[model samples]
Target: MASITPWRQLLLDSIQANKHLRHSEYFQLATVKENGRPANRTVVFRGFIQGTEKLQFTTDARSQKIEEIKTQAFGEICWYFTDSREQFRIGGFLNVIGNAETNPLRLKIREQAWFQSSLDSRLQFAGPSPGIPCVKNGPDDNTTPKLDPAEGPVENFCLVTLEPQEVDYLNLRKMKRYSFVKTGDFSWTQRELIP
Candidate 1:
């Protein structure tokens, strides 16, 4: 299906392309740590929320990124497609969803995700929190954690969403680029940029 707008199409492209990608999400996420330093990591692309201004990804609630997001809601996603020699950088406000206080839209997605995720995936979040050191490394241990005895949705599952305030798309093959800045709610002012 063709997208209604170029901006939507670009984002949709990223979401659709993520499926064939394994080594990366066809993008990278940059979040600011509480210490005012930049931290970049790879995240799987979930999808854009319908009739809204957000992109989604799943993460362990215990991940350090959660703390960073709680401190600062600002973040960016950089998407590059080698096949098309194109790059799309999206800067926006980020929010972590999947709790009692989270809105229903995100809650619904998280609910579906919980059901689809494998037992092994759920077990990951049930273990020690991310960045906490342990005597034995997970891979070296030659054993994986078992699912919690209760056998329910992992308590740590969360959906991370970004609401874009700016989108910059560049096409190296054509030597051109454009920038779109949010002008108002669900609206943006676009401009061609010097590539």
Candidate 2:
């Protein structure tokens, strides 16, 4: 058996150790527009496509971010690991995860989880609904509403894919960093970086 390189070891460790990173906390995604300007937002990571090395996240179909990606297929993702004092910046092409017929199951699951986690009895009817005025109500009036996983807001869901072409890792311990560009399948061209 062959030994794992330090870079690969670090990446594996970071991914496995933190379950939060597996969700939508550390992903800072940036997408460009046809005018060459950039739009960025913090997105939640839904899952990874193991075979193609693609990262997945959820978004709204009518969101400005998705519209921007439609104009530009390239994007960048920044992942910061506070525990390891490391930051990973991945730049790659953007891909939409579904077709006209097929729905994004992964994104749906994540959305359901997010909805369930954020449910307050007082805020059950607080979503976007016609004729529902947008005004702050008293806490007593904001009772948590029951969420039906099958009947929640599913029409607005979508998934964004990030195919990393370049990944740069910065380590705060040694004040060292390494940059990796996709060279071949499961392989990369690595370069050392200045502190």
Error of 1 at 24 (Å): 5.9
Badly placed stretches (over 4 Å) of model 1 are: 1-3, 14-20, 100-105, 137-143, 148-152
lDDT of 2 by residue, 1-195 (tens): 324545556766787766564442457888886688887778766556544467777665556776788898888888887766778888988876432425566555445444543344213333343234555774535554455644544454455677778888998876989988878656778889896
Top candidate when judged by lDDT against the true structure: 1
Candidate number achieving the greatest TM-score relative to the actual structure = 1
Q: Model 1: per-residue lDDT, tens digit, 1-195?
A: 222456667656754664465643546999999999999988877666666667888788878899999888999999887666678899999987755535665677777666666677677776767777775755646655677544545678887889888999998989988998988765677799999
Give all candidates' CA lDDT scores.
Answer: 0.76, 0.65
